[model samples]
Every structure is written in structure tokens, then in C-alpha cells.
Target chain A: MSAPLRVAVDRDACCGSGNCVRTAPEVFDQDDADGLVVLRQAEPPESEYDAVREAAYNCPAAAIEVTEP
Target chain B: MSDTLATNVPTYPFGNAGLEPLLPDLGADGVGRVQLPTGQQAWLFTRHEHLRELLRSADFSSDFTRPGFPLIRPIPEDMPRRPDGSLIRMDPPEHTKFRRMLTPEFMIKHIRTLEPLIRQTVVVALESMRAGGQPADLVEHFALPVPSMVICHLLGVPYADHDYFQERSRILLAWSSPPEQVRDAIEEMRDYLTRLIAARRDEPGEDLISRLAAERVATGEMTEEELVGLSVLLLIAGHETTSNMIGLSTLVLLKHPEQLRQLRERPELIDDTVEELLRYLTIVRTGLTRVAVTDTEVGGHRIAAGEGVIALLSAANRDADVFPDGEEFDLHRGSHQHMAFGFGIHQCIGQPLARAELRIALSEMITRLPGLALAVAPDDVRYRDAVVFGVQRLPVTW
Candidate 1:
């Protein structure tokens, strides 16, 4: 079985490209005020691990980070 | 202080002659004062690090109406902004509010749904290009129409009106275009969009404009004037940037036949190649402008409050520190760090759609027309002297 995953976003570095939200809407969202990255779930269910990772990789600002297995 | 200002920077000749000369030489700090096409001087940030920092800072505003914003050309103070203005020209809350509503439309997954349609359009354009025979202009036949039709379809604007919008877009982006002509174009587009939005109100379709009307307009979350503005922004931006990238990227690849052959041989490389070409080309020379609302330090240079800042995206894209051997056009480098789409809150929102179009159009063009080659001498091919870098015409044969 896969271990739980963690998600974090450096809002300061977020480019508001919306790639993260698009890739993993379950785990990420854009702030209503500034469109910067907003983590919807710090530790989303294991089902979201792949999409969370994809968002981290595809983010133009490199703002999304995922850690632990 | 004015006497000490450096000579105004010229924004022409997209190759080395244009941005290269303006950029601070390598190993030097890359921030300095440079004049603009408006004859006003501002601090130009050339290094990648500096631009990234400035762009992310809230203090550096993207408000076009700001007193010190670096417009390529001056618009009259009384010239109106669309009710909500363009997302690129707004700061924080307002920009974010509008961007959130529009974000779903440009999402990669959403854009992918339209891939088949985009592909179909490309195939049709290519067939017509073939029927028109060799030595045909690719710009008119393929590059321009594919994205134009896609954007128009997305907006529910009639594709038949492409000639109208395309011409307006051309005048809007042309640096030499008079402000009066530019305003006239904007007024006409606003009128067109306003009428379209009103029609969509009664009987909406599945397209973006219809969705916007249903979700935002009916709810009073967005005003009609703002809807018109947003539609105009999407229409012009959707077609202009991608179309130019398509034309210029094709011209670049055709000029490098060996590289084109590599792409044809490895179709999987299409995605990376598009990113690399976007980085390498870094077209759209002048639109990335901002104004500092408060005193700030960028690259150790103290920029005063209300000072304008122009981040020469092409220069930053090639900054050797970020993109090693950045000057070379190596597609396999696989770096998506380029500022081709600008960055931060105001980054090009239509990038996913643009990327899909490019990846499809370019790969399909090479694969379908194995014999494709330029009809004109490399040097004789004309480039547009507009804000977006593109070939005026690409006469090609296979």
C-alpha cells in the first residue's frame, strides 16, 4: 500500500498560471483575491498523489512541493 | 538627473541586433535604466532572477492606468478602460477575481478536449495549402487561421469574422500603428463583442462566451462592459500570440532542417521542442510592462516609487545563469523555465491552448509534408516590426 502524501505551495513564488489547480483540483486551488496558489489539502488522500506530483512538476513557478512517500 | 539617463532602448530587429545589444553584457549585473518606445526611461530588468523577483512582488503593479506604467506607446489619460479592464492590466484582487472565472477555460485538461477539433482544423488547413500548390504562404494558409478559428469558435464569435478581428489585432500590436487607429480598432472590437455577448445572453451555447454569460453575467458577478472587455482580450490574445509563435517557430525549424529532421524522426519530442522553441524565440517583445508602487530593490538597484519597469522577457529567457548555454536552440534541453509567457499573476493565461496548437500544428506539418522547404532566401524572408515577433509571410514549398 502507498504511504500518505503531503502537499505545499509557496504562494510567494506562485505565478498564477493555474497549472496546479487544473492538474490536481482536489489538492490545489487559486486564491480568490490574488490567484496565487492555495493548498486545498495539506495531506490529500493517497488517490491524489499522482496528480499532486504532476502539478508540482508542471507548475511554471516551481511553487508546488510534495514530500514523503 | 535627466542628463544622466542612458539612450532610449530600441525594440526592433528581434535577433541579436534588438534585445542582445540592449541587455547588459554577461557577468555584469543585468539591471539598468533604458528608454522605451514612448520616449520615457525606466529600469529594464534583463536577468532571470531579477525579473522573477520583481514580477512576484505586489509592490510592482501591472495596472496600465498607473501613472508610471511603461506603455510602449502613450494612451490618453482619458482613454477608457474596459469596465473591469484586462486581467494583465490589473493588480491582485481584481485581476484574481476575473482570472479565477476564466481559469477553467484555459486549463490543460479542458484545452485537451478541444485537441481533436484543433487537429481537424490543422488537417483542413494543410489540405488547402497543398491544393494551393507549392510556394504558398504558410502564414495565410495555416498559422493564422488555425488559432484564429479556434479562438473564434471558443468565444462563439463567428469564424467568418476572422478577417475583421485579425486585421484589428494586427493594427493593435503594430508599434507603428497610430494611437488613433489603435483606439478605433479597440472601439470596433468592443462593439462587436458587446453585440455578441447580448445575443449569447438569450440563447447561450457551450462555448466560453456563453459559459461566461451564464456563470458571471447573469449572476451579476461580471458586468456587460467587463464581459465585452474580457472577450476582446481573449479574442486578440488567443489568436495573435499563438499565431505568431506558430509562424516564427516554423520559420526557425525550416531554417534548421537538421533539427526539423530530428523532430520528424522523434515525434515524442514535439512537446519539448515547442517549449524550447518558445524559450528560444521569446517573441512578443514589448508587452511585459509594470510600475513600482513603492520603492524597491531589484538586482541591488534601488528603484524609486512610481518608476516603470520593463522585463525584457527574451533577454531573461536566455540568461545563461538560468538556462545554461541559453543562446543555443537545443530542443532536448527540456527546460520549461523560460519567460516566453511572462510570469507571476499576469502570465499568459492562454498558454495551454497555445501549446496544444503549436505541438499539433508543427509536428503534423513536418510529418505530413516531408518535402516542406522555404521558397525564399533565408535573409529575404520579412519579419514583422510589431510587438509580437513573426514572419510577415512564409512562402513555403514541398
Candidate 2:
């Protein structure tokens, strides 16, 4: 099986458009106070791989980063 | 490149002859130079990839005062400088500072909390429309007031003053409004917000204005003038765009009964329906404007420093590459990548709230008013000739 996916987010670059949270709620979230990306799971399961990829792709601020190990 | 006059440019906003908003023919590359009404020439990027590249690039500046910044309408010579906290017209790091302060208030989690309020607003508006008798203009009865009341409640502004503020917002947005009138509207709006901010300062409430006033302004993180500018931006933007969307979305649904029937049958498709509507009716027809801060290449086209560019969002949304048969609306197509709320740091902060409002409003309207139908012929429905494309009045009967 392929290595599990890893995800990261840069709060500084996040404009809080919430596209990431909406796209991959299992892997990403928005901080309640500041509204920046709050990565919930750095290593998401195979089921969430597509959503994580989409979140990174559509992030307006280019804040979400994903790595396949 | 030769100095092409861009002589074939259509009017500021290309027409909406039918379902499709007309676009200037930007040949195969989907990029062309166009002349603005201000007699200035700017590059217009119509392709989705080009727009994504242009909007997300750091080389572009959103500041209107920058030389070569594309201005669709003339600004009065004595008009006040760009407002201190008008986020759309600002470039980072100034834009970043203000956006960060406001982001939390509009985040998806936060906006979700406002859904109950939005639903109630939608329900009351629908009932009020029915009570007003059939053939009521939905724009005035349901579309305009729902967003207006919600925004007013959030901002600590009185909904009773909507007529006062809404009229000024209309003049401010109208492309045909005289420069003097636009200037007057700006000054009047600022004056109104100034007083409201002062009141919020004195008696803090559970509202956004109160929190910002007590926290940011009082703490010196932001100025009172900045707060006024910010409030003005939210007050106008918070209502106008969504109101227009609600009005136009209804008309589009009425036009497409098959899709409407599908939505009615499966309310779970509300999210998809809203996204499709936003993409198909990319209403900010004037397009997002920016100036190149430095030399850059977008989609292989060289853009020199100080050159202006207009990202034709409506055209980009319909680009066939990103969206297959994009001209046709298909509700099931997941359209999250659509730039309806724009892209990059300057992407709309209130989009989550807008989406919530749209989802709740459309679903409730469809469910509550099953008989909703346009009262007039499709051609007779008047469209707004403003920066935001929408119907001026949608007379509907249920």
C-alpha cells in the first residue's frame, strides 16, 4: 500500500476563506478565534486522500500543503 | 506587442442576452487587451488557468491609486483617497492586517452558528412576501431584506436605516452614476457609519461592530476611521452581492424547471445547487481588476510592470478546460474550484456567510414556496447595470 498522506497548513498565509475546511473537514479545520487553518490530522487515512488533495488544490491562500510518504 | 487600440471592446459589462453573459471574443489563448471606459487599456484574462495564475501572483497590486490600475468608471477628481480599511482595494501587508482581524468573524465554523438566524430570516421574508399578496417583487420583499436584516443585525446597525443606506449603496454601485453622486454617496455612507461606530464604542453589544470597536479600535490596533471604512465595506458588500445572488438565482431556477425539480426532490443537493448557481451566474461581471507590480508572465503572456489586468471571472468560470460544457449548468458537478468568491488573500471574507445564506435561503424558498414562479415574461425582468450583475426587480408569484 502507498504511504499514508501527510498534511500541513500555514496559518499566516491562510485568508480563512474556509475552502479547506469545507473540502476536507476530516483533515482540516478553521481555528475558532483567528479563523486560520487548523490541521486536524497530519497523517490522514487513505479514504481522505482525495479530499486532502482537493483542499490543497483549491485553497485560495495556497495555505494547505500535502505530502505522500 | 503592438499598441492595439482594443477597438472592439464591448461596454463595461458585456450584455446578458440570455442565460450566458456576453463576453468579448478573446481568441484561442483566451487572453486579450481591452480598453476601459476611463480610456485606459488593460489586459483581460478570460481563461481559468490564466486568472488563477494572475490572481494568486504577488506581482499584481489591487490598489486603484497605482498607475495603470484599471478603472471601469471615472472617479471624481476630488474624491477622497481609498478608504483606510477597504480590504478589496488594498494590497498586502495592509490588506493582510485588516483581513486577519475580520476573518474569524466570517469563518465557516462561525458562519454555521449564524445559520439558524439566516433560516429564520429566510422564513420570515418568504412569509412576508406571501402576505404582501401574489405577484410581489421578490427583490424588494424577499431577496433584498433577508440579507439586509441579517447584515444589519451582525453589524449593530439598525435595519430601520436600510432604506437610507440601501439607496446610497445603489448610487455607489451603479456604473452610470455621475462622479459627483458617487462621491456624495461615499461621504454620506461614511458619515452614517461614523455615528454608528461611536455608539458601539460607548455601549458594546454582542455584535461585530461592538467587538471590533472595543477590541481593535480602543486597543489602538485599528483606528476609528478605519473601523468606519471597514463597517461601510461590510454593510454594503454584506447585503448587495448576496441580495443580487438570491434575486438572480431564483430567476435562474424558475427558468430551469428540470434542475429546480431535482433540487426540490433532493434537498441534500442544496450545496451543489448553490455552488452551480454561483459558478453559472458569476455576477461580478465587471471582473476583478489589478495592476502588475512587477514584470510577470501569465499563461506565457508577458505582463510588464505597471500594466493593468482584469480577471474576467464570468468568462473564467465558463472556461471549458476547467469545466466541461461550462456554458451549461449541471448541478451535480462539484464546482468548489470556481472563483465566484475570488481567489488569494483578497478572496471574499464573508463567503462562508454568503454560502450559508444562499444555501438556507434557496432551500427554504424552494420548500416553502413550491409554487414560486416568475410573474412576468423572462425578457421583461430588468437587470441591474451595476458592478454586480443581478436583476433589478424579480416579480414572482407563489
Candidate 3:
């Protein structure tokens, strides 16, 4: 499995409230300049599996399209 | 389906558009226990009258931590709404205490004090646009700027950082925003607040943050996390919802040329008309989900203790029983206690602030640019679909 949870953001739809980045900092990074989410890693380390899942689930917009890689 | 929750099913929270005929389906005798594809049977509420009982009732709770909670999915083990358990995420007694600390700040009197300031800000934003020219992106020109500026001023945040803060607010709200983006924002913003708090501790300021840090919260009366959560919630809500309202309400007003004409003729109707727009738009989609404190009956079904309940505030507002012509957008209609600010103990604390901003923005447009109309066809305009109920771009002309 690449990353236990893979989350992709639809930048156009994001409001940059930063809940996902705070919940799963390892996987989700909000662009400080534009406030868009930037994937820090295409595939996160296995150790961060649970964190990624939490981030995806907590995403308010349900914008985090999660994948079990 | 590994991710059974994801499929051809409706992620559309308010799935159906033509709900006029479905009002009777939700009666005093209504009952619904649908089995989610996830194999969970959750009670559903879909009527107007009953929803009032459910929201204002002390029986239902917003605490999502309890067991057997009726939520389709958990609040993700990651984001603890209150890292230190803020009142916004808690139940009574403690919730009352925390709410009391902040409620006075939002009291009608305290909120009205900001109206003058709000009026000034709206004027500046509008004038800058009018002076610049006729064509403008309403979202950028009026909708986004006014709320962001007001929120920043209220929070003791330096206006210099408005761009960064606004940008962060945007991405964090993008549809399905990734965790990294949000986490980075939380940490960064928290750090900024920490520094701001330190400054207030040393010198104090005229904003809410200084008052909060100097008086009750920071003195061991409240934890650092609670303080952070409240500030962030206000910062987010203060601007996000109002910005959307400004944008959405503009569309609503412009759509019905007759109503817009009526409003232009009589600015006195702006307040009630704004409320009507709030109810009709219900733009702030449901992020506020509450868990059952104990076994409770609502919307004519039994929701067991610990089940999470998502209120369809907008749907509830449009209930035909509540509004004579619920779906119709009528500016002349009488008072409607719409759920735009939601119901319950956790109803939007910043609603007064949102309302004030809307009143100022809408009234200014009517008085200054009475000729305002959509520069592009309604369909051509874009909407930002995700965390907040708002349009992406609203191009307008006068």
C-alpha cells in the first residue's frame, strides 16, 4: 500500500480554513501564500496512516478525496 | 466497496431540489430509519416544525465523543474540536460557563457598537470599487473584503496580514481540502495567535483578543486551546459566512429584478429582506453536527443516546409549513425565524456580527449602486462549493 490514506484537494473549491492541515500536517499543507492545500508527499510514510485518515475524514468540505493506496 | 460511503449515492447533503411535494411526507406522524450503505441505521429528520423542537431542545447534544453516536462516520480521530474542550464543542454547565464568558461580547448591544465601524468599512470597500470602475468581481470587491477586514479588526489582528489570513481561510475551505493544507494553517495561525496573545498581555489592545487574554480566559479561567479555538472559530465564521451571505444575497436580490427594485425604493426593508435572504439562502452549509446526549425522539424517530445528528438547517428553513410560500424568494414577507444562524445552544455565536455586515453591505449597494445587476448570466457565475456556502466569483455591474 502506498499511503494508507491518499487525499486529493479540489483547490478551486477550498476555503483554506486549515482544518485538514492541522489534523494531518504530514500529508496536508496549506499554501501560506494562496491558502490552497499542497500535498507534502505524494505518498506519506506508513507511520502517518492514521493521521492521514483523520485529516480526510475531518475535512469539512469532504474535499479530501481519500484513496486506499 | 472498501470506501462504502463513497459511491453513486448522493453526497449532496440537500439532495433533492423539488422538495415542495415532499413536505407532507414529514408530518407529526413521520418516521425514518434508513440503513446507510455503511451498514448503519440512522434516524433522519426532514420536516420544519419538528426540527425546531430538535434544535432548541436541551435533550440533543453537540458532543461527538459519546458512544453509539448516530453519525454516519465519526469525527475522524484526528481533529478534536476542542484540543482542550472548548464550550463550542461541549455540553451544559461547563458549556454555559464558557459561553457566558463570550456571550456578553456578542450581546446585541456589544454587536451594535460595531455597526458604525461596519458601516465605515463597507463604505470604503464600495467606494474603492465605484471609484475604480463599473465592472468588478463582487466577491473580491465587496463580498470578501468587508468581512475579512471586519474580522481582522475585531480580532486585534494586524490588517497587514489580512491577505495571508484570507488566503489560508480560502484553501482550508476548498472542497475536500487536504489535511496538510489545514494542519499547516492551524499550526501557523496558532503560532501567530500565540505571539499576538503575548503582545496583548504586554500592552493590551481594543479588540476582543486583548479583552479575552487580559480579563477572563487567559487567567487559568480558560485553557490556551479553548482560547485558540474560540479565536479561530470567530476568525473563520466572522468573515466566511458573511462573505458568502453578501455574495449569495446579492445574487438573490439581483435575480428578482422586481424585488431589487422594491428594495431600492425602500431601504427600510433591507433588515427583514436580509433575514429572508438568510433563510432562503441558508448558505452556511451544515458543519455543526450534534451528538445525542441520551436517547431522544426528534423529527418523529428514536435517536439513541450517542448517535450523531446532522441538522439540515436550510432544508428546515424551506419547510412549507413554516413559510407560506417557502420556496419563493419574497422580500416583502414578514418575519421568519429562519435557521440561517441555526438553532440550539451551539447556534452561530457570531450571527450578530454576520447580520450587521450583511445589513451594511446590502444597504450600501442599494443606496449607492441601485442599478446593480449581474454582469454575467446567473448560470455563468461560479460558486465555491465546500466548507462554506458561497460563490467563487460574482461578477456584477451597476
In model 1, the runs with Cα more than 4 Å from the true position are: A1-6, A10-69, B1-27, B76-78, B81-83
| TM-scores for candidates 1 onward, in order | 0.88, 0.97, 0.76
Tens-place lDDT per residue, model 2, B175-221, is: 77999999999999999999989888888889999999999999999
Q: Write the per-residue lDDT of candidate 3 for residues B154-221, one digit (tens) a residue.
A: 88888788787788787767655566677677667677777777788788889888888878665788
Worst 10 residues of 2 chain A by lDDT: A1-10
What are the per-candidate TM-scores when only chain A is compared?
Answer: 0.91, 0.92, 0.79
lDDT of each: 0.80, 0.88, 0.68
TM-score of chain B of each: 0.94, 0.97, 0.88
Over B61-86, each residue of candidate 1 has an lDDT whose tens digit, in order, gives 88877777776676655667543657
By DockQ: ranked, best first: 2, 1, 3
Docking verdict class for candidate 2: high
Minimum summed lDDT over a 10-residue window in model 3 chain B is located at B15-24
